[model samples]
Target: MHSHPDDKSLRDLLREQWTVAPVRNPGFRAEVWARIEAARRTPATWGAWLRLHLLGVSMVAAASIVFAGAGGGLLAGARDRHEREQLVQRYLISIDPHQSSAGEGAP
Candidate 1:
């Protein structure tokens, strides 16, 4: 890399910036305290509460939805399994006359 004759080195430039102090605002502290007091005085609102507990609320809603879907799927699977069993029993009965007579007598 090439350097300009007038340009200061990176280290020197950083040192110069680091030594310079920031200007202080006279009313900065009082303004911050006033805002804090105002916030404290205000009543808690629904929107603020929701914002504060947004992550928790969303997690609960998602969990409820997942549970509802899983329950529905389980019920559907059970009903389908029961229907398939009935279908298989009917098919077996239709194919054998002796088994059909025995099943009817036993039931």
Candidate 2:
């Protein structure tokens, strides 16, 4: 049988009641309340959260907008290239439907 310091078996202990002392010293409550008040006076702010988590995303988004505004000509070049390729494909299809551009023989 399991026994406590008083050598009382758990079953025997069940019939008796006991008092529990305070778990902490008297000032522990007041000190905890003071710490809580201090924390309330200076709450953890969102500035750190913004700087750590959102800053990279915000920077990338801002850079994207800036590049779009200032370097939008890049897209124009890509569009022109696409149009040129389409024109070439049409011309090749019309002029040489069977001849490969690589000059390979067709069976």
Candidate 3:
């Protein structure tokens, strides 16, 4: 049992708070339902949709970009390989006239 000078006042304040009734707003429930209905009626915008699925959409876009870059690199590599092979064949034919005539006769 500790006694302080302010303890009694504190007890009285707590008692008053405990006995006080909370004020209720009658329109609160109706207002909440109205807001819910309004939200339901409104169509979602593209910005809102993007925000909701931002993670999935970003992953898909990144994958598409990566695949496109890889495909482009593969195509460029194939083209370079074909050109190099053709250049080697032309060099060989220039040095060997008989080889060029044999290649022309073959399919």
Across residues 1-107, which tens digit of lDDT does each residue of candidate 1 receive?
97776677866887777786689899999999999999996659988878878999999999999999999999999999878767766887889856665665332
All candidates in order of TM-score, best leading: 3, 1, 2
The residue-by-residue lDDT of candidate 2 on 1-107, one tens digit each, is: 74566755754666565557677688988999999998776636777556656878798999999988777788888898878777776677688885346433322
What overall lDDT goes with each candidate model? 0.83, 0.71, 0.84
**Candidate 1 global lDDT:** 0.83
Collision count for each candidate, in order? 0, 0, 0
Q: Which candidate number maximizes lDDT?
A: 3
State the lDDT of candidate 3 residue by residue for 3-62, as single tens digits: 787798878978878776689999999999999998996658988878878999999999
Which regions of candidate 2 deviate over 4 angstroms? 1-66, 99-107
Report how far residue 42 has shifted in candidate 2, in Å: 23
By summed lDDT, which 10 consecutive residues of candidate 2 come out lowest? 98-107
Off by over 4 Å in 1: 1-48, 100-107
lDDT score at residue 54, model 2, on the 0-100 scale: 82
